[model samples]
Target: MPQWDIAVPTRPGRLPGTTMAGFSDRANTFVDVEVIPHPGVTVVFDLGDLPLVIDDGNGQERRGPVVAGLAPNRVRGQGQPGSFACLQVRMSPVVAHAVLGAASEVSGAVLDLDDLWGRDALRTQERLRAATSWEDRFTVAEAALARRHDAGRAVDPEVAFSWARMVDSRGQLRIDRLAAEVGWSRKRLWSRFRSQIGVTPKRAAQLIRFDHAAHLLAAGHTPAAVAADSGYADQSHLHRDVTTFTGSTPAQVARAPFLAVDDVAWPARR
Candidate 1:
């Protein structure tokens, strides 16, 4: 197994609701990484000798710059034997709608960046590949995100508020109460949230809850304890959720390489 050289911003950038990390594998390594489901959206800028390979178990593999939408499941990254470097950005569904522009309704799928950004995506990749340092790459990436965010449409305030509440509650918040708090009827909230955020509120909450429980498991917490703490009905409920989102058991999730790198990549949040 090859460990990633992860670099995060020394100081927080101006972009709100977004985080950036740069990952490079300098050794001649072939890595097959199982990617777990996450609550937010992910964008990867491939800056390596070869394009990033993503397999979703559908007998098809996608390469190059791609966006992993919220709750993308059963996906894996298979890197060829050689050095590889990339800049990765994770955005809240709220911010992702704006930053991702045409791909705003992305959920449960991985789409090529060029399909959405067209020539702009290729230009941004070139800029990232040309950067002399990780810091420069981060700068270029953030600037590109900022531009898209500014020009793209934003989600409704109610949708953003509901998302924040779910995140704050670690996905334990009730959907009914969220709608009330947002001053929208349940039907309206559901329709808007699904359209703008890419997933329904209930599903989003489940994903967020799964994310929290996954991290706790990665932190060495026992499944039973994590289940009780994360609002799962019981260990069985937790088991089902974990299996649904990650296609892995609690034990397997606890040792996931993707989660293991989070503390180093997003230390403050961890």
Candidate 2:
């Protein structure tokens, strides 16, 4: 993990509720990379000359450059091409549907960007690779995202409100409460939310809660303490979630390379 240095791009004003990040692997040997389901949708672009292989737990292997939208419990693996460099854009699901223009298509699966963006995917990659600096690349990428987001239709406001509640409460908010607050019946809310956000409201809450607990564990908190602080029922509940979402125990996730670099790459979490 130490050798996999992450570079955080300066905030570009093009896209709202989006974070652009870059990772460079100094190690010139092949390594395994696994990404658990986070609260947002991920769009990964390869800047290197080698191909990036991705397995979306779909019993088939898909290669990058790819756009991956994962629901809760959808695990993905990446085979690094010895030395690799890539840029990843994480958009809150509410924004992702609009930005990617394929929320329903991308939900619960990983697909090549070409399928969604067509020729634009390769064209964007060329622009990204031609950029002189990471900053320039970030600008180019964000501009593209902004264009799509502006052109596409957005999710329902109720869906956005429910999602905000999930994040603001760290997934501790109840679905019934969210539905009441948004003036939607429980069934209606559930239907719209799952359709718009890809994952259901309850599942989204679990993912957000798991994200919080994972960070706490990585910060050296005991499972018991993390469970209590993260609003889980107990340590066993936390363990089940960690295993279900990540296929790893608390101790293992604590040392995970992907979660390890998050603080530096996404420092706004605090």
Question: What TM-score does prediction 2 earn?
Answer: 0.94
**Superposed Cα deviation of residue 180, candidate 2 (Å):** 0.9
Q: Write the per-residue lDDT of candidate 2 for residues 50-142, one digit (tens) a residue.
A: 666777776777766677775633455554556577888888888889877757677777888888778888889899989988888888898
Superposed on all Cα atoms, model 1 deviates from the true structure by an RMSD in Å of: 1.4
Least well predicted 10-residue stretch by lDDT in candidate 2: 72-81
Model 1 per-residue lDDT at 186:
95
Question: Superposing all C-alpha atoms, what RMSD in Å does each candidate have to the true structure?
Answer: 1.4, 1.8
The per-residue C-alpha lDDT of model 2 at residue 41 equals 83
Clashes of 2: 0
